[model samples]
Target: MLIIFIICILALNPIAATENSSDWKTQKVENVNFKLAPQYENGELVNSKYYTIKNMFIFSIRYIDSDSFLKSSYGDDASSEDTHYIKNKNIKGHNSSIIYQERNIDGVKYNTTYIYFPIKDEIYCISYNGSNITQDIEEMIKNTPKQTMSEKKFYSKLTHATVSYEYSQREENSYNDYYYRTPYQYNNQNKNQWGKYYLAYSLGRSSRYYY
Candidate 1:
């Protein structure tokens, strides 16, 4: 089964300072048939669950030949036909977003927020997800140091990465359980993620698609 091996980013709050929260702006755009969500603008917590503290941004783009776009924009081979981006049905619903690691592109930097659909060979569809690539960029948005978008560099670094595949093998048992592993390639070098985090891995079969 195709499962989304999500590296749950126990992400930290934005750390930079900004004064751009003049007011909250919420706009929804539909690209082709899918939707586009470009920024994180607000937050509200309900029933012990954070309704929308807006830690993520989302956008969807549909292409007749989705593979072509992924290859050109992200690399030589990409697909999004199988990619799924679930909506809350209601604006207040919570769902998952597919985001790859960040990277630099064409002298500009942006963290990628996209999901891919790799068909027989190339990608079939994709969605522009979110990016919080650097500490400075994150700080600027979260208004960590402060909380606004005014004086900061007006841009965030976005990375479009090659799709990745991961696999695991385990002994089958009557009862199902899970374990944890440290994240790969993330530099929390200067940050202290101490008692604030945990990881879980299932010892049985569980599949999920990220969109």
Candidate 2:
């Protein structure tokens, strides 16, 4: 029953994006096998790689420890508008607050969600980009297997599509669902600059894992 309003994100064209032969590669972290898609460079594992969904959004996922992540992201900065804490009612059995951060990089706005929790004796963090903390995202964190790595992808197919107020009355549920049903691309006529240029490279990629 967790729901949040997800605003329209700027879209991009997907090029040089690779698809996995299978799904995710299995790696054991903290005594749990984690399914991951570590970018392979010349057959060797790389730390991070960019994922581009045609006409949607581009994002990257990396593996790092909780302490390093916190220190690197925020160094001795007090709480403010850019950084805030939110309580999630959907995540059960965990006593941690979800930290939300908003950043503007090169005039492009980015939203990040951070969750810190322990797997057995070791603490770990999972983060991702989205306009808001939707219920689906919280459930993804809540159900991650202890000691095992879990992978999730949210994406879409339409390159020219934009979800706007004019088309908001569609009956489909979930943001992903909305994209799945709405295939008409947005025409910039009479639209504002933001609306005309909105793009999300991470649409229609939900519950998918790759190797």
Candidate 3:
């Protein structure tokens, strides 16, 4: 009788097959909606540029095919990292290794973290970097909901979804043509050297700096 009941339950709640990333289910958690972006190569998802949302945060998710590939991409950082800080955290019920690195870009110092974890047969690389870090961004990892098989489809869609963006605000500073000063720099000298300071702005918690 128990065996029969188990069989009935299995038949009723059949496992959902994995689908491509394009068809993955999207859900909103903590007022943020996460949708999969397709950009993969050789069965691995690799987005050259991050997807920025809300003008303050940026994120990227990549799929690693095998342990061999994971080592190839993260050989030095995973093992012989003598300078940066490395640690582990339980994320989404999985033990994820986190590595911190810092570098100066255009005179601005930016902090970054590389988070690596495995799910089933493949590994995931989730990373974020910015001039400032916040608790909300840190919570993003912990609060991510466990996805179903159908939701996993979004990750697979990245293989064919690597289309380039015509103009993304995230990459606005990269192009040289976008800069034009109004009212002239000479005229603004009398003005505050740091002009247009706002009275109020949101403050985010700072992450650990490399050095």
- Off by more than 4 A, model 3: 1-58, 79-83, 105-108, 130-211
- Model 2 over residues 29-125: C-alpha lDDT tens digits? 3444444433321132233322222211222223434443434332211133676655433244443335676777689876766554434434444
> How do the predictions measure up, each by TM-score?
0.22, 0.37, 0.37
How high a TM-score does candidate 2 get? Answer: 0.37
Whole-model lDDT, model 1: 0.28
Q: Which stretches of candidate 2 lie over 4 Å from their true place?
A: 1-45, 48-70, 74-81, 86-90, 145-211
Task: Judge candidate 2 against the unseen true structure and give its global Cα lDDT, from 0 to 1.
Answer: 0.38
Q: Looking at model 1, which ten-residue stretch has the lowest summed lDDT?
A: 87-96
What's the C-alpha lDDT at position 75 in model 2?
24
Where does the lowest 10-residue lDDT sum fall in candidate 2?
152-161
Comparing 2 with 3 on lDDT, the higher-scoring candidate is 3
Model 3, residue 63: C-alpha shift (Å): 1.0
C-alpha lDDT values of all predictions: 0.28, 0.38, 0.44
Indicate the residue-level lDDT of 76 in model 1. 25
